[model samples]
Target chain A: DVKVTQSSRYLVKRTGEKVFLECVQDMDHENMFWYRQDPGLGLRLIYFSYDVKMKEKGDIPEGYSVSREKKERFSLILESASTNQTSMYLCASRSGQVRGNYGYTFGSGTRLTVV
Target chain B: AQTVTQSQPEMSVQEAETVTLSCTYDTSENNYYLFWYKQPPSRQMILVIRQEAYKQQNATENRFSVNFQKAAKSFSLKISDSQLGDTAMYFCAFMKHEGKGTYKYIFGTGTRLKVLA
Candidate 1:
């Protein structure tokens, strides 16, 4: 079974705090992604890494950064957490696939709240 | 670039019934992939079914099937004997065959489904 694990399930932080959300995949997938989901907005990609230390900006990348130092772990960082940053964050990984196996296995999302 | 659309913002099915969720996409590329993903309350998104644009036949997985209309760029999911566990947010996604290299997904605004016990 493929397992994608997030560092936290629920997090609360001050408005000025720097936050880190970690994701680790045991399946050795080559592609990983971070997405923030809002009520009616569905899931919007923040960033993605196709390989270790290689990253690409998605549709929304402002106020966020990512790290992929190792092949199994990807991290999403909020430079300065804000009230607007409160939402469900999801991490996903996919194997070396071009089309048919494009299905991404996702982690149980982390719901973060900024005060 | 490709875009996915889910026309139904919300849907409901009584337990043990059948339901269909609509999805449409716009892409100029001929060979691509379409997928249906279900995000339950637990916030874990799971792949429900997949459809390849080049394939003429629809795809199915037990109770979950898809009606793939390639010409119209339409991909719809049909759930048979819908159970309470089937209630979730269903997202339709599209990914282009970017050679034999990498492929990225473009997802739709999901449809929220409710199942009555």
Candidate 2:
């Protein structure tokens, strides 16, 4: 089975600290995305990478940055963690080919709490 | 810009009963894809069903099916024989075929479904 693995399931970080959330996919999918899921607000996109070293900002990219050093791994970085930054983070990947698959396979998600 | 709306924030169904979750989208693009994704408690999100706007026929998988109304831009998911495992948050997503391989998806707020015994 194809899997998108997140490095951490739960994390607690202090304010002003830099936090990193890692996601790796074995599927070799060309597209990877980072989204923060909040209650009532649903999931908001943070960043997406289509290829190695290629990244695009999404709807809510503020206070967040992403790195895609390799095709299989995408990293989300919180430059300065704030209390409001605490939320459930999800990583997803999909085949870039528009023809075959349109669905995204998501990781179990990382729940980060900032204090 | 495209947007998806799931007006029903919460729903409940008895086991073995059927429940329908409503989803509506706003978009000018005629060619697009609609999807329903389910996220169980503490589990990864998974795709439940997908519908291509160009197709007139609704898509189905086992006890799960979709009611697609292209003219109204409404796509709803129906779950039959609901089980306890079916309790989860269901999201409606819309993706416009960019003609190229790269595109973004817009998701609804999501509907939480609880299965009652």
Candidate 3:
């Protein structure tokens, strides 16, 4: 089975602290994404990487950054964690090699609480 | 920009009954994909069903099926023989085919479904 593994299931961070959420996929998928899920906003994309060392800002990328050093790993970074940033973060991956439409495999998600 | 809407925030259905979750989307692209994703209490999102815009026939998977209306841009998911395991948050997503395997998904706010015994 294809798996998207998120490093943390739950996290608590102090305001102004830098935070890192890691995601790794074993399927060799070339596309990785980071999204933050909030109550009314649903899942808003923050960043995505289509290839190693290449990243693009999604709809909501104000306080977030991403790094894809290798094809298998993608990391979402919170430069300065704020209380407003508290939400459930999800990591997803899809096969770039696949033609046409394909569904994404998402990780279990990381619920972050900022104080 | 593409946007997905799931107006029903919560829904309840009895076992063996059927429930349909509504989803509507707005996009200019002619070719795209629609999907229903289930996020269980464990917080893992899984694909339940998918529909391609070019296909006129509704897609079905076992008891799960979709009612895709291309003209109205509506893609609803119907779950038959509801089970306790079916209780979860369902999200409607839209992905515009960018060609060469490049696309991004826009998801709805989600509908929470609870199956009663």
Give the candidate number with the greatest DockQ. 3
Give the alpha carbon lDDT tens digit for every residue of A22-100 in model 2: 9999998999999999998888999999899999999999999999999999999999999999999999999886674
Clashing pairs in 3: none
Prediction RMSDs, each to the true structure: 1.4, 1.0, 1.1
Q: DockQ of candidates 1 onward, in order? A: 0.82, 0.85, 0.89
Q: Can you tell me which runs of candidate 2 are displaced by over 4 Å? A: none
Estimate the overall C-alpha local distance difference test score of candidate 2: 0.94
**Tens digits of lDDT, candidate 3, A12-114:** 9999999999999999998999999998788999999998999999999999999999999999999999999999999999988786648999999999999
Superposed on the true chain A, the predicted chain A of model 3 yields a TM-score of 0.97
Winner of 1 and 2 under TM-score: 2
Quote the positional error of residue A70 for candidate 1 in Å.
0.7
Once fitted onto the true fold, the runs of candidate 3 whose alpha carbons sit more than 4 angstroms away are B99-101
Better of 1 and 3 by TM-score: 3
Scoring model 1 with DockQ, what do you get?
Answer: 0.82
Higher-ranked by TM-score: 2 or 3: 2
Which digits, one per residue and each the tens of the lDDT, describe model 1 over residues A5-114? 99999999999899999999999899999999997787899999999999999989999999999999999999999999999999999987553578899999999999
The stretch of ten residues in a row with the least summed lDDT in candidate 3 chain B is B96-105
| Candidate 3, B9-37: lDDT as tens digits | 99999999999999999998898889999
Docking class of 3: high
